[model samples]
Target: MLVEFRPHARLRGKQPADLGASVLPVVAAVSASDTDLGKVRVVCDWVQYRNNFRDVVQLRPILNGDLEIAVDVRRAADAPVGELTSALLRQSPDRVYLEDWRPGRDSCVWRFNALYWSALDLWEKATGRGYEQALPGGESDARNRAAAAELIGELFAVWDRLAASAALPDELYVIELGVGNGGQAKVFLDEFRDLDRHRGTAYYSRLRYLMCDYSAHVLDLARETVAEHTERVSSFVLDATRPRTSLGFLRYKAFLVYISNVYDNLPTDEVAQLGGRTYCVHNRACLPGEEAAELAESVSATVDELPALVHKLLRLGPVLLAEACPDHFADTDAAVRFWQDTWAALRLAERYVPLAGLDTYPLTDTLTGEALRPLLESGADVRMHVSNGAVASFVDTLGLLHPFGKLVCHDIFVDDIQGYRTTFRGPGKYDGSVVNWVNGPLLAHVGRKRGFDVDYAPFRHRAGGHVVTMTAQVRD
Candidate 1:
């Protein structure tokens, strides 16, 4: 049996074969790998093996004639070796393949992600709380008053320079994507107005603040929060990934595009360079047949029918789903409850396939996978999020910036390639949405290529957190 430990640095100075020796007895007794040999992989943890493992001790079939035995080492270590081995040896009696393992970006997890935003009202109403409550501090740091003041101060200086030259536009544009509860926007606009008055400038009156988000409910809530600045605020329910498609008129006009806790939530795929071969990680979302049957039974349905019901629930929110399937769901609340349960039990099965070539892989419509080679080759065996959606959004949003403008994002960012080796960078769930650390190095590389400077610094307002401030501006 082949064993792999992750963060990979976990086995520092040790051989894979040597580190796997503890399980040799279990392997010998089962002789599970005797027939398939290298086809069997014993994975150590879930952070790196999330695609392949869901439980403390579990087994999954990799489509390419391989078997995966996944163990949560942290949880499994306390159990008797025999008990752990027995758990491993147990066949997945009701396991069912839901989708062919595909790239992380294509996984069904994202469908659930989109559902969270589209159905935000129902989810929040049913749960009696907004999604922002799920954040680390039960709120975002993007609304920090001092941070907003500093940013507004900087923008004022830029506007001041242009005003002196008689080049300032009549309508100053500041677009904020992913406006959470409008706390950040309120802070920003409040500061901008205060600063403008103090500086004796007209920039505040000239400001056009656009609040954009995927959920109309979120936008509504944010709009209400910033009601005091309603005249200056314009809200749009646009997909964050395709902002340029909606804000095309603002091309080369926006002075400040602010994004916070957003890039990390966008869809991303993961790539790994191991043993000198690069591979793209693929995943499939599935419900263990046993769990499916149980969840189905709770809803008076069958296991085989669960997947379709789920797709329906995702495409149509619980109320519509309940109305459409009266036979299964007793009411909207029941349907919403079922949706919650299913999401909690959702699992992703993952595998790595050798990349045919980097050039053939598409990073975005404009950028190709070839752009990732340098980052992937920078260190030892490493797996990192491609941040596909984030990259597309970043590059496209840059086009919306005036040459003197800037884009500032506050989110989890992996500032150095070496950071990948030392830590677990997400694909973690934030409420019902997905979160992955934005690829800082990759973003910097593309920014420089586009004649922009991208830089990162730890978020200064908060004393302890992973949030970083990424600023992209035309290179001087």
Candidate 2:
């Protein structure tokens, strides 16, 4: 059977006027008997669902936690939440609508690591257009294209000051991370060339514009796109989270580090405050081959195996595939294709497990766990971005800048934690990648800790966009 439910009347469309009260009978009936199946279906953009109940089932919107409720089904009023959840999940393949939680450890959203390491190439390969075409406002331009232009205007102001002061090196450097299609790089280089010519500053001749990204394929394309500025342009394939490793040669030398919509794409873990307690959100990833486009149940993973499998695939995708089939090692591209398909079909089941404290938060392995404690604030119930990757990336990039240098970035940012609790911030899909609202306030707080001034303001040239320009520099 299929059912439709709403959390509230005014939220979006229509459900029953008394939907919440009306669905109690249906839920209680299913919980009492095993023959009747009680499944959950999330009616949100992040997930898609199909069953006979679409027009048949009547559900009241029991919108509580993402993976916490099974139409509020429980054995009794006092049944424990974890036990109830485990029991509900064991009831065959029932539909469970989850908002922000996940099922277990190591079950990441998958879209992000997949994109950065492999699917990024698939983005242009699968589609003739570049990945940027997936931008909401359409075409290769970001919906915030106006803001990109605004970013350039501000860059010039910073540059003019640096040039006049003469404290910066003669080899003035402007490094842009995540240079999509080299459009911004092209525009920036072209503008700098002209600006130098007009001002007779000779800045263009001495300019070293370095473009960095995770995808070598994108870098090659960007190289071709900006061929006109070959003399002053160079490109490096580097990880955004650890900029200083490849960037060591230019340490404390680059005058400006520019980024656009890059931080939001980096990996992040979501933490939530609920009923005066905190929990780490996790997801159990799967491939139900029977599902519309996903893999089948035969290939579905066990709880422990899920993380191990994802890790093995990330570390030795081709080797593992070949070990399973020795004859196909010669056809490397075919293995790549299978991996791409798997990533595309990947789906996550959410679960929110309670946590002990900040000391045990997961990002600690890759980032300073203690540094992130402040971001997990306690107040009126809310959720916030842990932006571990962004903070790690930002801190490393800051160290690479010269004394007169600064870091300029533009992306969807929540200037306050309340924005996350009240607004529709996301881990939404963009092409084959994930786009999140990087925690701006958290980044600023960390910046101040390192003796730097980090400030956020609406992109000056635009009016109505979530994009904010973040500027970070050593305190004057």
Candidate 3:
């Protein structure tokens, strides 16, 4: 049951007669309890909307009414005079309205229909559980556990691919942008512990995990999550859409940045600043043009080059791991065509080189043509590229061997039609990309321009889907 409120009778000035006729009756109907004149308590919260300047009021009655009343009001924390005049004109005669709402006020009405909450509700409806229930924890859930294991395995796999001639950094700062319940974080931490046992304590101690989010409520939840790890993790509250303030950049310098389900929230410039090694995951849902329009108004910039923003982020760091819903692209051929066209339109054909010699590269048996051919053959379509990672070593090698080379390695993966369907089920969907050398012969032409030695490990993998990871070293 949802209740709506409008301060303005029409669009401009309040129509007192109309309010008395239509608005008051609606409020009275919703607020009326078991008794004819039952009282309803209104909770006022200080949070205000940009367009409207009215205090949010929530009505709770002792007895259920025929209609449940929920009023959403907007007010400015700091507004000039007459801001609440229109809102005040629409007040119910018999109902008590809470005034001057602020944070920590129990009377403030909470925003219940936020996007995060909506997504949670949708997930709950799909999974047959309360939205508040914790997702698959570190143990017992085989599918989630396997996904975690695969992600951890990819970290090293990516390292091997990029570290061929370089050494691992002394410290790896990993920041997960949208860590919902820290389920994946826990799995990664567990894997790191295992690696410590096998490699050395020093290797483990040098690794730090930071989970960032926009909501203070979510940040509070993460505090408990980090507490479970006990000194192994920490959390921060941040708006990723905002620019990297001096303080933010100081806090976020790291070997890798891991963002899950956050790309849709950021503008291209913000994404570009998130350079350094980064791994991002997002669904295929296209951002509504209106939403983007609003963002542009606030940020004062149009999002004309979303793909370029992606490319910039990939190049900022040597290795990047990004995932999106395959629904964004229509099919494998469509996916290829999309990139081909995207690069052509951007006049950046020379900057991106698809990995062609996939067979010669050390690929897992599961990643073979027998496993991937069907998706290509069946015409699997996608809304966005899923499971993307960039090898910085490849980037560096291209830069060194071909000074003028601006090639970026990409691995394209399709999961629905693949034999290893287990990998696609845990997460929303699966698509893969890798650095293909056969498709990138222009490398020699570009490599001759510059030559320099870079120390990084060569990435090696037994299979394609095993791990989507990349690693690179930055020298002082």
Candidate 4:
């Protein structure tokens, strides 16, 4: 573990070794009576040394319970201030697993997952906005409007060609996977409507915009936002990963499947390349205090309980909530407040576990078992996203596109494998849920296997954001 001290900001210099060497300086700096807390970034890098993966454990305790530990073991670990390292050592982690797809918890804290989901539910109920909107200036959809307008213009160009050849579908479909507060959907639909009116193509009348999400609460909020175009709007409660099952009725019939900031929020597995071998890096979510630990345990007691809880909180109506938890309803408002508090207490602990082989690691849906060739097989030593949910969602969503239809997605995409090593992304808390950088190269590979032309570029609608625009179309 390399402990770097930045009393106010990060400093560059060769610091001394562990305890007395590094600890004494921090201790001396904080010896002042007025200073009670300070920050230290402890990065633990685990290199393949022996049969079992050995982590180089180093510590520079900054006033204890105030150290910022970032574990670069398996995947990049995002530890909050004041976290201790406790590895499983010999077994699978008890708390953390690869996240299952849930609309409300597309991303989750391995620790305090239950609290996180409950907090998100409480927040949506209280604010009618998602965690994305909780950030400053994150509530705006102007960039999406520009992106949507450009997309619509291109789709209309394709539509004109299709119509000239008499191949246009009577019902043109535009699907959005994660519709946050319907801000982007409203912009998209409004632009499409305006474009239709200007061109006098009557495309708006034939347009069927499907807002698919896992949370009914979220969908309800989307509906309220896009209420003006109810005539052409439809909503479905479906998993983005396995959209084929619920949206099978419209298979190969839809055009323009659009997604905004959805792929980054999906659940993904972390894989690492080391010593010419690929390994599945595993970590469990760990909370600090006993109270926070208990809250995490209560929420994730079962294997899939956290997702079930989130789904219940999101999909269940108020009357059903009253019926399900009759005892907790006496002080429903206070009960709801507790949910938000639990989410704020989440922290993560990570370690690298040597994989015997890549034989068992699940990569793509169709290409698994011995047939799977892990992307991390590259020569570089790096960790990256095995975005199972995003890939499955991309594959299944592409299946819904017509011959002329195109899939457009905007997200925080890691276009190169090298980006994972240098940049901070994934396995981190946003406001109430987890946010990860989607692996664009992996998605592009999957698209190639499926005979689709997949490409990525910087999000032209915005600058400085990590978001990349990914486009997929049927290859000739």
- Give the best candidate by lDDT: 1
Better-scoring candidate (lDDT), 1 or 4: 1
Cα misplacement distance, residue 361 of candidate 1 (Å): 0.5
TM-score of 4: 0.72
Could you give candidate 3's per-residue lDDT for residues 42-124 as a string of tens digits?
A: 22222221222122332222122321232332322233212232333345322222223211111111111122332343333
**Estimated TM-score per prediction?**
0.90, 0.73, 0.30, 0.72
Where does candidate 1 have its weakest 10-residue lDDT segment? 14-23
User: lDDT of each model, Cα atoms only?
Assistant: 0.82, 0.61, 0.32, 0.60
The digit string of per-residue lDDT tens for model 1 on 202-273 reads 777889999999988899899899999989999998988899999999999999999999999898999888
Arrange candidates by TM-score, descending: 1, 2, 4, 3
lDDT of model 1, residue 112: 86
Q: Comparing candidate 1 with candidate 2, which one achieves the higher TM-score?
A: 1
Could you tell me which residue pairs clash in candidate 4? Answer: 111-285
| Best TM-score among the predictions, by candidate number | 1
Q: Backbone clash tally for model 4? A: 1
Off by over 4 Å in 4: 1-121, 125-130, 140-143, 290-330, 369-374
**Model 3 reaches what TM-score against the true structure?**
0.30
Model 2 lDDT tens row, 1-476? 33333234333455223333334444444456452343443221111121101112212222343333333211222334334334544553333221244522233554335544454665455456667766654432222445554555565677778667865466878898987778888877776677668867777788899999887877887899899999999999998989888998998887789888789878777776655567666655554434322322223433334334444446665446547644433343554554555555555554556767766665534554455555555366565667767888998888998776789888878988766654545555565666678988888987898888999987776556567888998899
Error of 4 at 347 (Å): 2.5
